[model samples]
Target: MKLQGKTAIITGAAKGIGAATARLFAFEGARLLLLDKDEANGAAVAASIAERGGKAVFRRCDVGCEADVRAALDTVVDVYGDLDIVVNNAGWQLNKSLLETTAEEFNAVLNTNLTSMFLFTKGAAELFIARKKGGAIVNVCSTFAVVGSPGYAAYHASKGGVASFTRAAAISLMPHNIRVNAVGPGTTDTPGLHDGARDTGDEDQGMKSFLALQPLGRFGKPEEIASVIAFLAGDEAGFVTGALWMADGGYTIV
Candidate 1:
């Protein structure tokens, strides 16, 4: 149990990569605080963890809302006494070319993908500083953060912000023993991906297009990404900070 007795808060943990990470962290002996806007799904994931003999609690949180995020973090710290790890994994995708993207749409993507990271980092850093115990923060980025995609201008920009923010935050927090890092995953098979495909009205084509870009000829699994995140949050990665760890299955190689 690499994370035995640690307390972790994972955002967007109702399903997909966030959910997978929550399960893995629980198994590794972390008391889990899972947050998602979907109450039913979040509660279901928490219930499953408890059934497996792991400790967990679920809360409905819209990470984009500052008040909601603040209250949620306060609740976690109050319940667990200390916060050891925070994973900023809540995000959404909008497939729109730059020309077709509206201001509202662009803001929406930024708020969820980038702004939420800022809010959580701010809130968590305060807690860590107050406790005088350094903690780890893992921001979920995308391969697109480094590579440009035609129809993902907003998403790319937002994730790029995450990558940059991760580096800056890491440097600033190093003196406090806080480590800030990010994981850039390639296209993974998650509920969010499926939903994006459906929104494009070409689920099959969308999936095929994603597969074609991957050197592995297949999309990644949520657990694969979760594994990298778990490593980053563990003591094994103590010396690593201000880094963007890529798990793109060679998608960025080309």
Candidate 2:
């Protein structure tokens, strides 16, 4: 169990990458507090883990809200005793060009996708420093951070910000023994991706277009991406920080 005895909080844990990551972490022996706005699914995730003999709790949260963020940290302390890892995987996507996106849409995307990471990192770092224990943070970014597309302008900007914020947080938190890193997934087949596809006006066409860009000819599995996040969070990656590990099916290389 790579994460045996660790306690973790994973945002967006109701679905997609966050959910996958939570399941994997629990399998690897981490007690979990799963946060998501989707209360039913989040609770189901926690219940499944508990059925498998893992310790897990579900808490509804809007990750971008400061009050919600603070309450989550408090819940971690009260429920799990202490925290060892933070996975900032909550995000919002807009499948629209700059011209098509509204001012409100852009701001909401930024708050959910970028600002949430900052709140968690700062809170986790402070807690880790206070407790005199090292911790790991894994942020979910996207290949769109480095590459560009005609649509998802706001999403691209948010993920690009995630990559930069991760690097800076890593450096700043290094002295306090908190490792901050990110994972960039490319064209993953998640509920979020499907939603983005629908937003493109045609799910079939949007998906085919995404698959065409994948050099591997298939999308990265949620489990595959989750494995990378588990590695970064565990002690096996003790020397790693300030890194953006791209699990993008060779999308960025070409």
Candidate 3:
């Protein structure tokens, strides 16, 4: 129960890595606020946690919108009375080359993938500062942030910004006793991947290509990523801050 009594608000908690993290955090004794744009799925996830004797609430929120983000965070604090952790796990991707990517597409990815992090961090940090209690923030970045992908120029750029912002936020929040860090996961098996494949109109081939690039011979599981997130958010990582922990299965090593 590393996070016993802690309150967490996780964006993108409807499915995949976000959902996995929510489950893990509940297991570790944290009260949760699960945020996602998908109301049905997000509510289902929250119900699942509640059925397992965990405390959780679901909110329909589009992290890309500052008003929505602020409202959700405010609601969590109202219900839980305090917010100690935030996981900016909401993201979007466009598998288009630089030449094919339009400004609108780039902005869309940037809004969800990067800007959301900033908005949540700013909102949460203010609360933490006012309470004079430090908090933890874990941004979900990508291995692509460190390495280039063929058709992910905008995605790469957004995640790279997340990495840099994590570091900067860590330093800026240190005085408030807040810790900010990031997790970079490699090709994880998720709904997002399926969507990416569908976008290319060759699901099998896209998946196969992704698998071939993983030296581990397989894609990572969402739970695997969640475990790392739990670690970083807990006291076990008390001394860790401004670090980008890569959970990619040697994708960047080769």
* Residue pair clashes in candidate 2: none
Give the per-residue lDDT of model 2 (tens digit) for 13-77.
99999889999999999999999999999999999999999999999999999999999999999
Query: For each candidate, what is the lDDT?
Result: 0.93, 0.93, 0.94
Could you report the Cα RMSD, in angstroms, for every candidate shown? 0.8, 0.8, 0.7
Question: Which residue pairs clash in candidate 1?
Answer: none
Best-fitting candidate, scored by lDDT: 3
* Superior by lDDT: candidate 1 or candidate 3: 3
Cα shift from native, residue 236, model 1 (Å): 0.8
RMSD of 3: 0.7
Candidate 2, residue 20: CA error in Å? 0.9
Clash counts for the predictions, in order:
0, 0, 0
Q: Write the per-residue lDDT of candidate 3 for residues 1-254, one digit (tens) a residue.
A: 87899999999999999999999999999999999999999999999999999999999999999999989988987899999999999997898999999999999999999999999999999999998989999999999889986798899999999999999999999999999999999999999988887888899988997888889999999999999999998888999999999999998888
| C-alpha positional error of residue 5 in candidate 3 after TM-score superposition, expressed in Å | 0.4
Error of 3 at 251 (Å): 0.4
Per-prediction TM-score to the true structure, in the order listed: 0.98, 0.98, 0.99
CA lDDT of 135 in candidate 2? 96
State how far residue 153 of model 2 sits from its true place (Å): 1.2
